[model samples]
Target: MATQTANALRFLSMDTVQAANSGHPGAPMGMADIADVLWREFLRHNPKNPKFANRDRF
Candidate 1:
């Protein structure tokens, strides 16, 4: 699951950068694993309403 999540993040970031033709992809690619762990273990936010008050961001 973690590996899948990391791969998803990496590809998504790369795709976004490619589509926009801007921004740095290295940051997202490098942090994919960390992001996967955090999203799966530490961070907490409402997927339906991410900006909701009292919910953790990032």
Candidate 2:
């Protein structure tokens, strides 16, 4: 699951940058695994009410 998310993020970054003909996509591509893990496991959110005053969004 994590590997797939990482690969997907990398592919999206590369594709978007390539299409735009600008920006450095390589770093994001390389860091996707770490980013995915953090976001998927450690990052907190309240999707039902994202703007809730007490939501631990950070």
Model 2 whole-model lDDT (C-alpha atoms): 0.86
Model 2: lDDT of residue 26: 78
Residue-wise C-alpha lDDT for candidate 1, range 1-58, written one tens digit per residue:
8999999999999999999999999999999999989987888777899788888777
The clash count of every prediction, one per candidate, is 0, 0
Reference-based TM-score of each model: 0.78, 0.77
Give lDDT tens digits, candidate 2, residues 1-58.
Answer: 9989999999999999999999999799989998998887887766887787755553
Query: Largest TM-score belongs to which candidate?
Result: 1
C-alpha local distance difference test of each model: 0.91, 0.86
User: Residue 10 error for model 2, in Å?
Assistant: 0.5
- Please name the candidate that would achieve the greatest lDDT relative to the true structure: 1
Give the Å shift of residue 17 in candidate 2: 0.6
Model 2 ranges off by over 4 Å: 54-58
Q: What RMSD, rounded to one decimal, does every model reach?
A: 2.0, 2.0
RMSD over all Cα atoms, model 1? 2.0
In model 1, the runs with Cα more than 4 Å from the true position are 46-53
